[model samples]
Target: MMWPFDRCRINENDLFKHDWRSRSKVQVPQYIFLKWTLAFLVGLLTGLIATFINLVIENIAGYKFLAVFHFIENERYLIGLAYFTGANLILTAFAAVLCVCFAPTAAGPGIPEIKAYLNGIDIPNMFGATTLIVKIFGSIGAVAAGLDLGKEGPLVHIGSCIAALVGQGGPDNYRIKWRCLCYFNNDRDRRDIITCGASSGVCAAFRAPVGGVLFSLEEVATWWRSALLWRTFFSTAVVVVVLRAFIEICNSGKCGLFGTGGLIMFDVSDVIVTYHATDIIPVIIIGILGGFLRSLYNYFLHKVLRLYSLINQKGRMHKLLLSLTVSLFTSVCQYCLPFLAKCQPFDPSTTEACPANGWSGNFKQFNCAKGYYNDLATLLLTSNDDAVRNIFSSNTPKEFQPVSLLIFFALYCILGLFTFSIAVPSGLFLPIILIGSAYGRLLGVFMGSYTNIDHGLYAVLGAASLMAGSMRMTVSLCIIFLELTNNLLLLPITMLVLLITKTVGDSFNPSVYEIILHLKGLPFLDANPEPWMRNLTVGELAESRITSVTLCGVEKVSLIVDVLKNHSQWVPYCR
Candidate 1:
């Protein structure tokens, strides 16, 4: 799933230059020290960025929800809906304008660009200072607007930006430099540092350090080495430490919603879960469904993105209008859907159920009686993370009705497809998990008669299957789900589901990220050659292009000048 790499990274003459080799040897010790130092900085910055995004999202989105609920409670339904839709429009417009005006590269999942970069393509302004700024603030606005997307993927790109900025001596504009960091000026060293940064970003996003390392190895980085693996591990470890420290500091409730979940974003540790042999049958069904749905997800998302490309190419105004339209649609759905739910009376026998005030409760009282809660409101009104927690709660089987879940799944699928490919910073990871959990919970209810599996277990495996199917990853995704749930017992099932889902997805279209890469016109060279290429030869390909004049290692300077003057394009050298 990669394009052919044809660029020359190094000059063979450099290996023979005595001064270059001597200077490299002299800088070896400093290189070792500075790289680790860079790793620590990348991790620390990544954690801080993640924490920053979370805080912004919580306060802004929380207050928006609070305001909407306040208006609704006052019996001003029209005003409440207007305010909700208006708030979403304002927030999303701000994010979209940032991308359209300052850094268009900051839009979308950004994992494709990161993948392309790590594969050796030098994407212009990809990790630039402007892109970083736009990404940070833009992501805050879009996510806070309640779009069906996450910030995890954007965080990776942010971390890489920080790494590139720091490694490149803190931006040329600032004119900052360090003697020890000079070694990273080369493409190889900088790429490695960026790889570590990518891993640290994952660690910060999910609070899964080892999973971060595996993510970098499996998805982000194409060139892996022993030292890089160690550096990546160290970087992610530092991220975990930094995130833990932030969580501890925020435990006093200073940081808003982030203070709620410590490290695991979706913690099911308190829940007791166990599955039988027969449970495997339903789990397999979940995997098969996940793959089928994922194929549809990728296919439709690609077409939508293509359509968006046509609209976006029109102008910046068109991009802003598009964003506003989507935000309005989302706000309308979020506000109006809860009315369709049937509110049920609260059950006091089940461990102090429902809430008197604020969000995060399993039960949401939206235009309900004094003692009743609306099931669909709980899934709709609450934040996506909280919605996930409620669904993943093993204690809440009857908490959500089948109709409510089906509604959520269907609505989220539509919203998620539209939400992506917009001119704002967005992520697909958490939204995928959220939708997958909804699908899983629905499946659990469906298979209720045939099996006795806990709905929560089904939700976890469902998330794994969809994630694996869409991302086309197995080992890393399995570990990510394992770490997210903190339930080691679910590993075998998670692995099984991931393997099946990826295999099935491979039989269909490429993973979502690869499709996105293609959309961006980044041709990634696949390791496995296509069957139709069996007769294609290097000689025919070379003859199609302009002839290259290869020079010897000890070629004269005049000869090099002559070749440079003669050739219209690149002149390939010996590998």
Candidate 2:
């Protein structure tokens, strides 16, 4: 079969010059088909490999990070500190060297480079192989370091490299034997490769196949045309199936990769807030504040990056030193004030805490964690509306404390932002999400105490909203959480908050991906502009001295067929 890229269409008038049957009979060679098939198979295998890397990172590095260091206690604050410092230093140092040395295209989100590739731009030579190695090492290192970052970013590149290898067709890669060709001769299908990788990465990370394709199209390709959808859907589906199958095979067909059991099967019970109507006003107020916070984060991060650039002019080493220093300070703060570090518990006495007690069914307030998990737990346990009412009405703490949480968030954002700027091979998807979630939860506590709304729900809302705001990826962020927990009851509210937050953030700052690319001196980083001809208006083209086409009834088929076979014939009558 002729691939879409190789097929040349014919118009009605071409029938005058060529025979339809002869041209229509043209077929793709077996060898070329084999190679393309092999590419797909290789991509499938690489997808599984990429998934393996992700699983290992997620479980070992993401959750039990301190496990990397046998000396530290599992949940001790020092383990967090050591994990953040020692690991970040080494990772930062490696990233610094990699930036100057290999210069792979896997830095920051990997989305931008994929975007550029799709638009016919060239990526670095070592983009594929180097990225696969660097991202796994650096991200694992970052996770081991405890920087509040995630592995979703690296997976994008890893997925893309898998695609590239499948499509591998450089001159040096060819053999002299008779498999003679299907390779596109040119090595510029970079976008296609990267898009494949990115789509698969997002899919594997969230276990939401369609969402991944939407993300690659919306956030990476920025291509919403009809034709590209099928390929994107097909590729994402294929990769996810392979990855999931491998996961099942590894877990003995019992869904071991996503989870074992209890955590995934827990159900939420209805909550009775004393005055549900009264809470609407407060919830709305929380949403408005959440939007504002989203905007603020974008603003602060941009300013921090500017400041970091101003202070560290020496090179990657200076930048590394600066980030290390900031990380150390954050680490120290996190250790001294355990409440400040990533994913801290909400405080009820303060207006900022999430009102988790209202939903938890657990009328005993302040017992749950600070974020989403707590919110769900709260929804099931709270029984008395009066208890919920009393909890909301109780006088919050007299004083506001920003010294620790604020400092920790600031440092965390700074380190994450600069890490992207420094060209470290890493994914910004999770880091940005983590940053948004952390900031949202911290602010959520204040809103909870002041507004009497559930901080847990607010934090969950914040996590999704902030992610949507920062990355400018609302659909994927919302869908990601849905798939992660397989819960949808709160989807509507999540989408509403995400919409407001995204709009607010866009008004203030470029999406994270665009900003990173802009920092690297890239052009049109947000959208890939079409070539000049495609950009031309139909009116202008029609008005030009160009040939036209016209078509009649039965002759249409013959004309098209003739055009297909002719070398230099006109098809001006198809229209």
Candidate 3:
């Protein structure tokens, strides 16, 4: 939910300079040529190289080592525990060493680092071309090692570096001013250029331009006046264009509007426009719940950091051992649980039947049924046995009951938040939505008896609404969800839920990023704090005091003595 951007430091002295709104806009051709010539080449090279590294780490390294210690194949919990322990030990060693050597800036979410860098924090070693390699390979290693962190955070930094490196070759301030004399000339700050890369990365990841832009505006920068509004919009458009073109080249004519549609559609019949007033209550409830989830996630992360620090302070080796212990536990649980083990194999008789309880192969085809003993039930579902089929068909009504789903939703949220707080590098982006969707599915099964809404719609709507609530961006959330899924019909519902979640969430706590910055003693606060606040320096905020001294003297000796005495006291000068 953290939007991709933070705050910008505006120069107070330049406030009265030519108003940007009425200034001659940069011609599309020249400005774009500059960005494309530089930003594209840099971003492309960075992205492709990063992507390649991810492929190698994920495809090559993981398969080679993970297979030997994979006890989950035999459905043995103890063996799985050993595997998890061994894997965690190896991963922690790799992560700790690599993190110290390269990509040290990637310790936490790289968003704060990006914000700090934009505010002129000196990062002498902010690798120009090398960051691409580190971000790509490091992220791949982290994820493959099962550290549970997301790639988007590091991608933000990677993108910013690419943009900065590309823009580094651009004209300096004096040259930019001289060039401004030309009517066609336009001077874009490093912020816009960096944002172009950042947004493009977000768009590339989620394939949602509006969401990416909103993320930049909301979490990236705090201050925004009308001057920046239009410029950012134009810049976002350019970046989105770049992303779209690249995606098209990658997938070739499969994306709907942007990428894979999941929730909404653009073309809607007028008949589907019927929204009763009663929908408002449910929408509001959704928003509040979303905010609660966000708060819980943040709270858990805070606790994890605190606890991990305390444990590590005892000794560095102890911390690694603790992480290794967590890994063993997780692996043990994963192996014991039937559904977690693997999807049951498909039956020849029933096309919907899943595979065995434990399979090391692809899981994309399995039905992700929920519940504690869900694996056993799923296996039964796949079996051709008449007795198993009869038992499953009879229990279907109870299995899909609303009460059962509510419990699942609660657990899903808890697990999702926990997984993210573990401090391992994996994307939290989809996990949040996945949790929300699963919860929504459970709620849908319960609410279906009373409402006309389809369960799939509920699942998608819940994800959108919860995301909006967590992020606290209503319009942007709505537009993004609509764009991402190409589902226009759900817009009204998504908006309703977003409003509900944001209202409740905001009332309880500000954005998580603000809380983090406050805790870190960072100068800026809010998406955009006051301009003066940004200009206020640490020196200005310090308290000062003055002291006076007296001296006595006479003739030459007195004069020398007086000079020494005055110098000793550092007396004030009197002209």
Candidate 4:
């Protein structure tokens, strides 16, 4: 048998005659330009589609929550209950139906699936057109149903689908003949496109281009080349630009959707925190605690997933009903919490109260007081994003009291764990941040009670530590948090916490993604091997029988070449 590259080898005379640059300069430039242009276009389309999905989810969730708040304000408890229950039930049911009846591959965060795919495992329909549609709408519905899930993970899957579609020369049935760009039909180009799309998804989701590139490098891409790094960076940049444009357009010229000039809006100017040497003690403690908590969380999450699988095996309808039940329970709890808590009369004119329009410049009716939401439910569930921002604010308002912080920490830890891996399109990123920040704030509050420490700083540290522990990501998480908050000053602390968290977490078990991959029985080769196995020699593990190849003479040259090409262990012996 001939080696694959044997026919392509150049002779010495041909090598001397070949021009250094003249022969391929024009063609190379055009090819490079086309490839880059295609990458940029894919990133742009991914961003546009991801942004649209985010907008739809925001609008739907906002409307549903507002409706409940409106009824609460009118003192119509039963009607609000009915609306919340009905909406969540129908939305979750519909989302589950789409996943079950249409695209079963569309369920979950999709990061593990994408990771597996990148590692050369083929999951059917993962990048198909049908999966794309179902993933987009189903994720939107799942998030809008008030489930404690995020759109970031699903966005990754969506971006990959878009990239695959374009890279595969578009669909055959499409009317546009020009849609078929056959430049990226090869395996190498397809993989590169998918990697670019994954990075673009992170970029669009977090508005952190640099972090997105690092995330792609650290988490997704199993194999990386120098050129792919540049391509991923370009893709992330294009995605951020397109996403920001859409956000500004949707917000009617506002700098950012969250009013902070970024995806996660936080006022960094309110409190400037200077870390003292003593602060390291608390930071270290938080890191250790975070690692243990993550280990515990992953264990429980797997057990819960197993339970869910058992229930799912009963029937598709049973799975759908379970989803609806979870959504209904969550909605009812969120809605009823405001009424259950004591309402303190809050004067909007007061210094400490929330603004007249409330946290996000809307949803003032949910405020138990005129402008104050002293209620635990309001603090925890009214709007998760806003609540997180408040916790991170230097001069926190009345809503983010120390007690409220503690309650939120406990509540979200439970809720986030259970809520994840449900029959919904939930991403662990946001929920992990939410829970981590709450604990960090709680620690900050405690420190503030004793010394003049900044709670916001601790909140940031806690968030970084917990996320690192849960995800088992070190550099990527650090960069992501830094980019997400634009808190460059916190880099030292963030890096330390992540390092510690990862060290502690890895000592116990693998990351959540790795755990899920193992649970699914995907053939993932973990880079980290067991320490005990290091002492074992290859001979100890090998079979007793051995085969050897010998080249008797010049007549066996082709045989030697074939053996060399086919078997890495073959030794060509000449006698």
User: Considering every candidate listed, which one attains the maximal TM-score?
Assistant: 1
Candidate 3 lDDT, tens digit per residue, 1-575? 12222224443344325444445555535554554455455446445544443334434333522442244334464654565446645764565445445544444455655554455443544535555555665566555554434465666666667666556643243233434324222223566667656655554455466766677766674434554454444544555555545545635544222212111111112112234566555556556777787766666656665665566557546644554555454434333333443333333443333332222211113223321224332221111111112222211323333543454355445444444423333445544565566555555565545655555555566676666555556776677666655557667777778777777778766665555454444445334567789888645754553244443332567666766655533334333
What local lDDT score does residue 88 receive in model 2, on the 0 to 100 scale? 46
Model 2: per-residue Cα lDDT over 425-450, one tens digit each: 55555555444444544665665445
lDDT by residue (485-520, candidate 4, tens digit) is 565777887788899999998998889998888777
Superposed by TM-score, candidate 1 places the C-alpha of residue 280 at a distance from the truth, in angstroms, of: 0.8
Q: TM-scores of all models?
A: 0.93, 0.64, 0.66, 0.83
Query: Which ten residues in a row are the worst by lDDT in model 1?
Result: 1-10
lDDT at 39, model 1: 88
Point out the higher-scoring one by TM-score: 1 or 3: 1
Give the per-residue lDDT digits (tens) of candidate 1, residues 228-323.
Answer: 999999989888887788778888877765627544355666555677898888888888989989998999989999999999989989899888
TM-score of candidate 3 relative to the true fold: 0.66
User: How much is 293 displaced in model 2, in angstroms?
Assistant: 2.9
In angstroms, the error of model 3 at 128 is: 5.6
Tell me model 1's lDDT, rounded to 2 decimals.
0.82
